[model samples]
Target: MDGEPGRCGAGVQPRRLTSPGCGSGLDSLERRVRLPSRACGFLPMNYLPFRLLNDRDTFWGLLWSRRLSGSDLLRLMVFIMVACGVYGAIMAGWRSPRLSLYVAIKLPLLFLATTAFVSVFNWMLGLVFRTGLDFRTTIWMVFSAMTLASWILISLAPVSLLFMLSGVPALGTEAELQYAHNGILVTHILVLALSGVSALWVLREGLVRLAAPGCPVGLVLLTWIGMFAFVGCQMGWILRPFVGSPFYPVAFMRPDCLERNFYEFVFGEVMPYLLQGGR
Candidate 1:
């Protein structure tokens, strides 16, 4: 009731009435209107946000992630060296005409099998490191690393084979005959030493780029340790088996032996194909 002031009931102020849906009286109605308005429009889409990738971080991360321990690298190097020795044996054996046709066929097949085995081994290594390296990269890295090691072994193969072939006339001793074999062994050591130095250099450069000046001393120490362990273990493993099993008939039969032989053949025989200036 809009009763005028001073005119109603002892001059009391007039009462004013407001509309039900107007401002100051329709809080519930306003809320309902806003809610319905939002529903009629397009719903906000939920999107997964994309982060900008830093190129520098990506490159260095790929380079330095999952660094191999000194022991593991050493183990890998040794395995490669042994593989070279086995390869040399198979190549030498295959040259013999007296071996049966079946043996000849098996020799080539053995080489293929050895390759497959190494491929699998490298794949496993990638898995262990959780590296996203493709199979080709994995194989290439493995082969290149092993080739560096094989240089030493191949250089000494001639001497080792000569020693094995030449028996002492007076002593008639197979042990004495192995002295000639030491030449190939020495060559392998030398080549491995050279390769190790090169590998260490590459590793150092890579680490420096990765860690930057953040932890120079630690990186240097770690690299040094890895190089030493890798070289020493490789040399020791290859020589150890030979010493323990001299004149052992099964020495040439083992897959490990065949693998070593193939490595040597590739480095010694096929390496010429790879040289920029052919000899």
Candidate 2:
């Protein structure tokens, strides 16, 4: 009977998967094995402009949270560049057409080069302090500060333009126009100084968090701030006039840098208001 051609013998039987537990168990297994979507999207930043402008706590949190994702960093860097470019164009445009084009071309370069140099210096200081933050985070934090500066500069553009229009005399004799020129330049310098204060605050907060616990946070902060201002002022000077002199013929850039340092530029030239005080 067992060997009969059309008769079935005992054999392994396949189980049906039609039961509720069977299907549900497989789905449950998949749930256990697969990664959650939230796990995949760790701390993704959105609406950066809002966060950057109005949400300081969130901005600081994001910068320090982890290794920066390249996409986020790139977007932030672009915002910085565009803001700086806007400031450059607005500032130099008030002077002359040639100077505007020149500044527009140079501002982005100035941002990148200065950023890189400062970051390198920052990394060295990090090593001295034995700070644990990575180079990427440090750079990102610094750039975040610079972004604030650039935005402030952009906002001041209208104020600067207004001053240039009303304060700088168009057709006066050189001696007569000198006072107007001086006043406009002094006003712009003061506004830019305010912007520097905002940027320094951003940078200082990040640096404090990153510095080694035993490190003299004060010293480290001052050093970085001094270095940044020194390099930046010199770089600006080297890049030449953002506001060209009406006393001279229009040119895209100066033929050469002035034979003076930042201190000289401020005291000998910019802060002449101090020496002439109460006169």
Candidate 3:
């Protein structure tokens, strides 16, 4: 009798969770304990950025289901500016402190300006392609994709800085400087291409979801890319001096920036070779 199970605690009785929703208390407690015990030490709100990168399903789901408020947009814009700004500063560090500061300002401005100029067109194109994307949704989609790219660029800033310091000479002969500029330019192109590809991959599912039955998601994506690149390249040309060539002075914009567009410059340079080949 003394060794009886019920007698172990004497008068204390086992409590039964008979009330509805009572089990939730234990579940909540479990969650509270388990959440803090996570190795990342990330709180729910703080983990949203990571979720944006790795959890495409949830990220797009929230955007598609819920209307994002002004604060949401502002927060996203802030993140974009901060992330892009960091990479921009590092990108021109090899040049000088002034150029780094100039680039840090211009890079984010480039992104924001491009988005602002293209949003309406992008939305209309989405409609034509039957993607069911409204204006706000279209803007948010682009912003979100750009945010991904910004994150990627920021992540690679350290590597870029290393290459800038080691490979690109701050002071050298004209030939050496030209070679260094070419190498740095190519490096940035590759890094940007990778980031663009990754961002597009993240948006692939969302594009499909928005697209109507039988609509070609690939074509829609391509069209959007063309528009964005067309505008963005010209913007970059306008916001030149990001890399701060040793031959050129450190200015926010070149004096001849608006004299010609990027396409004109490209065409002028390539036509000479094309004509020579036909000759």
- The whole-model lDDT of each prediction reads 0.37, 0.64, 0.73
Estimate TM-scores for all models: 0.32, 0.72, 0.81
lDDT of 3 by residue, 5-99 (tens): 11222342222122223477545433322212232333343244554654444455446544346677787789889988998898888888999
Runs of candidate 3 with Cα error greater than 4 angstroms are: 1-40, 43-47, 273-279
lDDT of 3 at 170: 78
Candidate 1 regions exceeding 4 Å error are 1-176, 217-246, 252-279
Predicted structure with the largest TM-score when compared to the true one: 3
Give model 2 RMSD, 1 decimal.
Answer: 17.9
Better of 2 and 3 by lDDT: 3
Candidate 2 has which clashing residue pairs, if any?
A: none
For model 3, name the residue pairs that clash: none
- By lDDT, the better pick of 1 and 3 is 3
Could you tell me the TM-score of candidate 1? 0.32
lDDT of 2 by residue, 1-279 (tens): 212211221241321122123567456434322322231133322345434554444354445544247887777778777876776776666566667777776776676677787888887786787665568877887777877887787888788777766667666788866776677668867876887888887777666644445666667667778888778878877776766666876665566676667678788776886778835
Listed per model in order, the count of residue pairs whose N, CA or C atoms clash below 3 Å is 17, 0, 0
Model 3 alpha-carbon miss at residue 249, Å: 1.0
